[model samples]
Target: MSTAHDDLDNEHTILPSWERNAYAWTHSVRDGHIESRRMVTDGAIIDVILDGEPRFVLDLGCGEGWLVRALAARRVRALGVDAVSDLVAQARAAGGDFRLASYEDIIAGRLSLRADTVACNFALLGKDSVERLMPAVASLLEAGGRFVIQTVHPLVAGGDHPYSDGWRQENWTGFGAAFPSPAPWYFRTLASWVALFTRSGWHLCEMREPLHPGTGRPASVIFVLRRR
Candidate 1:
């Protein structure tokens, strides 16, 4: 059982953990070891983004730039941004348009780019960054643009734990032992997610639950939102 202090402390550990595991993450993703992403979330996010027919996209927290490359191949101009230096290097080496920028950098108005679509694929991890980043994302959208987010389904991820908002530890199960420090993620209830979007000057346009092909349970949830 985790106390409030532990949750608070865990929130601050996410980035460092990612920093330590960046290489392992890149390898796992490129090798197609993340089963949920390979079998479901990847296609789900792609379909949602392309559905809007956006010519330009900005992928937030784009690890290894796979989403950017995927969109680029489909004729959509995309730029990938991430905080991890090694991941950015790997992405650039792979011919991806990646910029190394932290979430705080983006929230501080450092990025001067706009796009018809902004996508965050399972990257909104921290509570503070997410609360501040949501409103900032609105400022980076072109006219009539959309923002798409794919994340762990609150209900599905809740499991035996209480369905509330707080930090949860990630052991990196099935991701192999090379991940030395698995990041702790903050979980938000379904209602909490909607409230956050509403307060952030955005409205949910659509919500999708992508089911795992084998288990037939929601593997993740996608939120398609537009600025209010």
Candidate 2:
């Protein structure tokens, strides 16, 4: 039986608005002081990857490849893939290994790169993207490999915004002119996130809500999953 979520998944399409401000977004997080990243996301994701001790990591939707550079510094083999050419170019300029490929291409069986761990940081924004990428993620990981995702905490993301399964425009309040055409992202509740992972044949292994250092509020949520 197809549920409402399934119906919505089939209807939604990928948004390319991120490409508009790719340069700005890349530069913003390059130094890693962008509130959320500095507060918790950076440490949380790196800790998970180090704990897994994987030979290689495939950073899906790796905008600008900051995480890839970080992992490479630790001598961990890491490759970043993103749809935006400008972002990939910047990553390469920063001495990071990055490929220009979209999630659509990956889901369609176009790219054939596998790794022991697949990490997506704050990139799973759309329901359609998630639905399409989940199966491809399974194919990209080795046996017993882990998939780590760090995204905005639903509770925090949905505080003022509606708490439903739909797309919402980014609050470009603090981003300044760097983020001109902010892209809208799909907001999924905690339960919805877990349900999507479960249906995609992933076992939820660990979950954490990293708090903001200054405000002490939940900044983002990290989920670690292993293929079942």
Candidate 3:
């Protein structure tokens, strides 16, 4: 039977949509309070990253550079990379070490950067990008380095939707004027996430689902993987 997942699988990339709306998105999340981030995701992701005691961190797809700035405050060398020019500019303006580069550019060896820890905070949005970027991520880390990822939990984020893979539109109902357009993000099942990492030569060291304090439902999932 035809399903939403099947429909999304047939669609092309959604990068252009994000590129077009980078400014609004960046402005929305600049303060870092965005409910979920303030309540759970921020602490969970930062705790995992700090536990590794990495000297250098590459914050891949670091939208407004909040994570990078936080890492720098901890005396770690951190750099943020984002494809969106406006977002990158905002990050730079905020005194963050940020570069305007896409995941595809990094994967294709156009940008050279290696780190003890590479973190992607709520940035791994598409199936195509994840598949193409995983191998390059494996290569971009120091030996025994870790890759920490914080993404929307597939189950909670999917809610009552079909579990099949596909693209889903962002829920911008409460975001107000800051979010002008809803960007469609690709969704993958938990099995798909694990398989992708395993196939890319990474061993999962830890995984945790951060739950919302109010509802006890998962707000996001964190994965700590080490190159093997």
Best-performing candidate as measured by lDDT? 1
The RMSD of every model to the true structure, in order and in angstroms, is 1.6, 3.1, 2.5
Task: List, in order, the clash count of every candidate structure.
Answer: 0, 0, 0
> Scored by CA lDDT, what does every candidate get?
0.91, 0.83, 0.83
Q: Model 3: per-residue lDDT, tens digit, 1-228?
A: 346565455334456667677777776676553788878988899899999988999999998888899888889899999887888888898897999898879888987868999999989887667788988897778888999999989978886889977778885654434665567777888898999999988899999998999999999999999987
**lDDT head-to-head 1 vs 3, winner:** 1
Residue lDDT tens for model 1, 116-162: 99999999998867999999998789989999999999978887888
TM-score of 1: 0.95
Order by TM-score, highest first: 1, 3, 2
Deviation (Å) of 109 in candidate 1: 0.6
Question: Model 2 off-target regions past 4 Å?
Answer: 1-15, 31-33
**Which pairs in model 3 have colliding backbones?**
none
Off by over 4 Å in 1: 1-8
Clashing pairs in 2: none
Question: Could you give me the TM-score of model 2 versus the true structure?
Answer: 0.91
Backbone clash total, candidate 1: 0
Model 1 global lDDT (CA atoms, 0 to 1): 0.91
